[model samples]
Target: MVEGYAVGIDLGTTNSAIAAVTGDEPEIIPNSDGDRTTPSVVMIDENDETVVGQPAANQAVSKAARTVQHIKRHMGDDDYAVEIDDEQYRPEQVSALILSRLLADAEAYLGRDVDSAVITVPAYFGDAERQATRSAGEIAGIDVEHVMTEPTAACLAYGLQETGDADTSESHEKRHVFVYDLGGGTFDATLVEIDLEHNHIEVKNTDGNRRLGGEDWTQRIVDHLAEIAKEEGDVEIAGDPEQEQRLYDAAVRAKHDLSSREQTEVTVPYLGPNYNLETTLTRETLQELTADLLDQTIDEVDELFERSEHAIEEVDEVLLIGGATRMAQVQETVESYFGMEPLRSINPDEAVALGAATQAELMSASGDTTADDVLPGEEEDLLLVDVTPQPIGIELHDGDFAPVVEQDEKVPISRSDDRFTTVMDDQTGVRFPIYQGQAEEAEDNTKLGEMVLSGIPKAPAGEPTLEINFEVQSDGTLEASATHFESGESVDTTIESGVRLSEKEIEQMREALPTLKDRAVAGAEQKEA
Candidate 1:
């Protein structure tokens, strides 16, 4: 029975968790380590053995160069890698290790295999990043059934939690809801219309940066500590990787501590006695240091509202969903900007995972477990509609970018027969370089992938016309098909350049997983012993 069921995975930037629908309620599935959430960290020991989660995080303090953290920010960068023991590991490969651990935990909790999952990503994740996420799932041996936006998932969790107390007979009108999510490594803001009566949740628009999050705030604290250490202690420790790692860990602890206290001390002991980097960081100081990052999120939210043609006054409620949103300043800023108090009913860290479980339950509902049957008028039957965060296009003559799918376009969208022609006389081939961004010049946009239409009948300029079609699925996956009108020849392929790994690379990682996992288990056992 569990084999056919699907679990929900929050494949987050800093932490990951899994959950599944039990009899009637969705429950978070704790990892094998008995933790509700696992730190998204991966480390390679000096022996070239692999370790993930908390163990990996512990290793990072001592061996910063060998440990990988916040790899999600580099998901779409094909050239980025963490060098370990003279071997390179891509972001997807590292993320796969995290996913593998989560999957193992899910299987343990469910008492059967959990091969299918609905993973959540930041709403603003572009095509390449989403593809890389899927690739990571594949490498982890999971059949990623659907990729849900983080804010949308949060909405589902909120609606589901609120439904039992609402009037089922009344037709509740749709309300425009806003979600401000700031996790450890990414931030996303989304506007959605949720109609409980009609069982519909439609996302209007989403905007955010993958690089901005709590980690940036922590870095601000770390920098402050380094400055104080140099000026007061006269120790130039910031330049050293090992000392920097200790400072980073200490700063993160202090940041979390300051959230509940007026002030916290950041201390990293030096090798010698009487020489350590120690400083008391106040909440006010923390706020001042990271005000610009906070403003950046506010600016993004304002832009989202403007682009969606929605006003701050029109927003019925703003839901905060992320561990970083716990910051008092973040809460106050968002509340003042939106003119409303952000909802904090659900646990920010667990809401996304819980909502993912709800979606997975919807996807795997059987004869006796239909979503409509469970809750009479709940989000179980709610339809989710996502939008593309940026324009998707191909390069044109004179280096202009011709857009096939514009930003804010509702997805699982398909645009067929977008026509283009050859620019030169006797042209035999045409290269369609795909890009995603608002820039007019193709060179200015982020190039995702490209396809070549060759063997076209040699013709004069503008004689050969090709109809290129683009399909962006609900999960933000992109696929293209091109047809030559003269010969009716067509070709189709996925965008593969930036983040999506090749089949051979995926296979290689797949083959390496068992060894990596075995070594990790052995290392854990050794530590326990």
Candidate 2:
């Protein structure tokens, strides 16, 4: 049976969008309330109703505490959270709300259930964040046809231009391309080689910064204005909640305007009945503030270029993804870095989702009913070769981390390393901290979770040969299994700390959304925040 209405979703840190291929053409479906792009904001109503998109983002300023945005960045980490009226909410639950809203919006437009969808994520996102995204999709009732890399997905959208060509055979047999993606909230550079022979796309080398993006640049501009406000009057705008919102709102406007204009002045609204204060900021000043951030992105992009083994000019296309690419400064920086005009053909907002939809079409057409699709030449046995975005390892005897799985290792793969017992007559459960990133020390990488292996049989320190095996599935989920070489005893489990909040946490946040919302619901809120 043909998969009905394959959908592609770009579940972004700042904004999210859903699109689908219409028969042979791609089309973005309007959200339930009749809008094209949906804000990646989630809010709760006074009646315990969960809301998403602009509505939730609107609350971000007022509720400031409850409405969660950029939760995508905190995926896999346990420390990040949103507390409302003294109750704590997990990032997973927050992301789940966003997914739910997307589903409701898509279904509302199509008049059908959207069970299967291909979601796009940052190529740099580790096992934890990728897994979190999957769980969010699951909770939102998505079948999660596949989780395609954002850059790879963008390539799918761009590669369509070469389709239906007479020379497609030569182009399909192992073509090389570089995907440089500088988006809002994250940056990813990947080397992708398309093998039409196997009808597969492989990511060669990946490099990026999780905390760097357009928002980081935008916030830096906001900081400059705050400084200007301080020096002009030794006054604090952020300290005053009312003035802070207006100032930020104006700053965003100025940032967008500067994308085309050389300089734009921002005037903030005056607070209090006296209405005595006014502030101005310029585009040049904004660039000055984010110079360092821009440099960092370029450095990483250069590193990826070196690893991809392709020169800057050799890049087939420089596809820009994310809303932040609208800034002229970002566009200019990219042009200078690659020595070419970046392709703005793909809607920074819709490109990822379109690529995602195209992947779903491929997955469905492959004739595999399950999430894992049909392999070439064989029905329902696709071989996916994915790699660890960052090197994963544990700390050794000294401060340095020992690589269990080297960076960018292939999937459905495993390796075992022999380890000596840490202590004499140890009977306690062995806890191994799993981390992802490119740091010489384990502390440098993001600690995803702890894997605990129990009942070691109380062996002498020097007597046991512990064989630890690290395995990654086709879906990019990781699991570590350790066995006592002597007895062949083994243990396996997930690495998540109980940090995944209980159902009670979800209930309270949803319950409080409305009360907090009504107090601040003075304007039109986006249907999906």
Candidate 3:
């Protein structure tokens, strides 16, 4: 057995969790607060010290300017940052703070050093988003072994935790499942094929809206209350940062309440003189307001089914994931559309973390660590094959996207021989701008990064041959290369998704870790006081 445990982390947009494999079972390692999940929030206290998770979330109401939430939405966007105390901090930095907390909690629980992990991300996340996730893990002092997709992790959890029922027995035939994952901040729908007999889990197709999820639904309620405040009391509640945060917090509570109760009240004080915003929002109204969001998810699922030539009838089962799936409307709408009941056995919040632990065990036993040294049950015969969620290509001479690898293609894959020639004679150098998306125009797609290939043989236009190659690693990282046919020379570069921190920056963050911890301790003490 390995001396140190390789943890599995579900670094989510709204909440995060960590887990580890114990013997043959995988269980969540609760945080110091004893909660199964930790809020993905960070705050810079009045003392300019960093506080993360639930503490930061609690501080958000009174200290809205210093708090950061939903930073996962801005993962790949280089322009996005959380401005705290007049300084801009990148999303990865804030996320690293959260990861650091999880690591600390895990170490406390297991009484060992935890260094390696398999972090889960949205299946539809592009190259930049995946890389950003890895960087976040790095900042947290983790060797992120793999970036598993959320749906895949959920599916893994489902498969490994199977009951002894004959229907799911070892002799049972292969099954196809549709995983509809609507998390707090991101939504992913993946079509997966599971062969229990062979222990193979393959992702057939995936689609999602990176910006849409349960948070948007809650935001809709918050916006509704703001409009009510405007019309009834002539107060601009939304315009104030503190008031907006309070309303959002209230909206979250109301959203949760509506899931179990038909109606809930959202009351926020100090809106205007002689006026307080107190309103009741029925579950029906909440569903009505966010009907389009649900429809949008369905559209993506339908798009996947269409692309894969799959009919709804062919789906053996549909699994609902993410905390948002707890809503009655979400369940009812999905059941009605799929013509089948969605699986509810798995815990949406913990499944990703649990699956990650199982994957961690698998990786530890099979990779680097020898199979003989692993525990008896640690090594499984399972095979996981995932796919890229978007097309990867380079800019063509006509300003069009020349796709070298299409979306939904199996990952850990490499594609090459897509040839391109220089526009002018004696062109000795070529710049390949790598992009990810389905847009026909290169400008419309996301430019992950650029690669410059020099020393190309000078030849007439249309005569010099330069072949571009795109290799997507299993974790969704893209490695693009340019090969010169005549010179037999090749240069390759990784397509970085966003502004990755340098080693020096990582060291700087490390130096600040103790201070951040002190601040969190102080914040907790103050909160308790």
Candidate 4:
């Protein structure tokens, strides 16, 4: 019976938590540490003992080199990792430790093993990032059934069980909704439908930068404080390790304080003693420091709205998700951007987790206990249709980029384009970089992956016929089938480069799991032996 349980998890950059609808409403399972959200910080001390959660954060101020923070940004990166004590830790591994803690806490509370869960990720997360998140679940002994979009999950939480008169029987008309998620480390903006019937909640479009979010705002505030420390306190402690720690913490607290009250007075004694400087940071200061993030979010929202056929006021709701939205300035900025006041009744930090739980409940009730309970790729009638987040294509003659499938092209879309040989008797492999973003040159866009069409037989210059077909289904995953149209041969391969962990690195991570899964397995083996 416990194996039938489905857990909902929100693995954030700053913290992580889990919940499930085993009882009435979804409830967050408290960890043995007496904390619901464990800090997402990790440290590798000189002793090589892995330090996690609050203990890791404690050393962050002093041992910056040995600790990793804001790692959620590099979730799917195959190249990025934390190098401490001459060892590297992948983003998935760092996140796995966080998941390990969540899994242990959920099992400890659920009275039996929690075999499956629906984990939430940023809507703008790329294929690699999404896959990396699923990989973390795998390492944690959890069968990830679905990786729910942050916005979709937020919408479910916003209206689940509490669908008000705005979206009830009499008022169950299809309406558009926007989700703006500004978490500690990243932002995601999504366009969805709220009709309960057709498409249930159709996802129209999504856009956001994985690198911009609340942590960047905090860093900006810290930069300003450092400048003030030098100017006002006559302190020249640029490389002073102790001074750096003091400044980072001071700035973070200042940002948190400015979210509610009008102004916050911060003291930086490390700058000097009673040389003690008290700086008053106002909401205006925060807005000024975080202007770029605000502008970027607004630009993304504006683009979505611009592409819509519906009027501005017709949108049913503007839902805000993520702890950063607690900032009054953030709400005001969103309100101004959308021309409508957004709802805040739901706790941003808990909304996504609660939605994940609701989905888990739906899946369990349906007798679907596997991960990916939520159908992926394009579906019809009851299916939620999603478009390709990027443009897929190959280069043409004269170095022109020919788009095979436009970005946001509707789900279940397929098209074939021809690529001719540019050089005479070219009988080799084809090399092309997969691109995302609207840019004319490959250098300006985000490289998603690479494609190589090989085994082309030598032919007269510009004589080889290459047919490339791109098919992007509802789930937003991309697959391509290319033919030597000349030879009528094709290969269907899903190419996504992910941050890889060597066996040695993976062995180190296993040793760091909150619960020793291998040891437990070995013990069972010994008992059988």
Question: Considering every candidate listed, which one attains the maximal TM-score?
Answer: 3
Per-residue CA lDDT of model 3 for 1-529, tens digit only, reads 5477898999888999999986657789988778999999887776767777887788787778888898899887777777766777777778888888888889888988786999999999888788888888888889888989999999888776553343534425677889999999999999999776556789999999898989999999988998999999988885688889988999999999998999987888887787899888999999899999989999998888888956778899888889999988999999998899999889989999998887887787444432222222223456789998988888887889988998899988999864787888999888888888888999888888888889887889988788988888776767788988889777988765635567787777666542365534756565785
Descending-TM-score candidate ranking:
3, 1, 4, 2
Residue 287 of model 3 has an lDDT of 89
Of 1 and 4, the candidate ahead on TM-score is 1
Candidate lDDT values, in order: 0.82, 0.68, 0.83, 0.71
Residue 273 lDDT (model 4): 59
| Rank by lDDT (best first) | 3, 1, 4, 2
* lDDT digits (tens) for residues 1-529 of candidate 1: 4345588889887888888887687899887678899999887776766677887787676678877889889887777887777777788888898898888767777887775888888988887787888899989888888878899998888777766756745436678989999999999989988876666789898889888999999999878887887777776765678888888889889988988899987667772246876667899999999999999999898888777777778899889988899998999998898888888788899999898888887787351455554343644355788888889999897899999998889988998754698889988888888999778999887888888888888889887879999998765668898889888877888764466677888999788653355535745664874
Clashing pairs in 4: 78-499, 145-371, 145-372, 146-372, 377-474, 377-475, 378-474, 424-461
Q: What does the lDDT come to for candidate 4?
A: 0.71
Per-model C-alpha RMSD: 3.0, 4.7, 3.1, 6.2
- Give the 10-residue window scoring lowest on summed lDDT in candidate 2: 370-379
lDDT of 4 by residue, 179-268 (tens): 889998888888887665333666787777778788888888888887887788777657876677778788888888988788899887
Query: Where's the lowest-lDDT run of ten residues in candidate 1?
Result: 367-376
Q: TM-score each candidate.
A: 0.91, 0.84, 0.92, 0.85
- How far in Å is the alpha carbon of 413 misplaced in model 3? 1.6
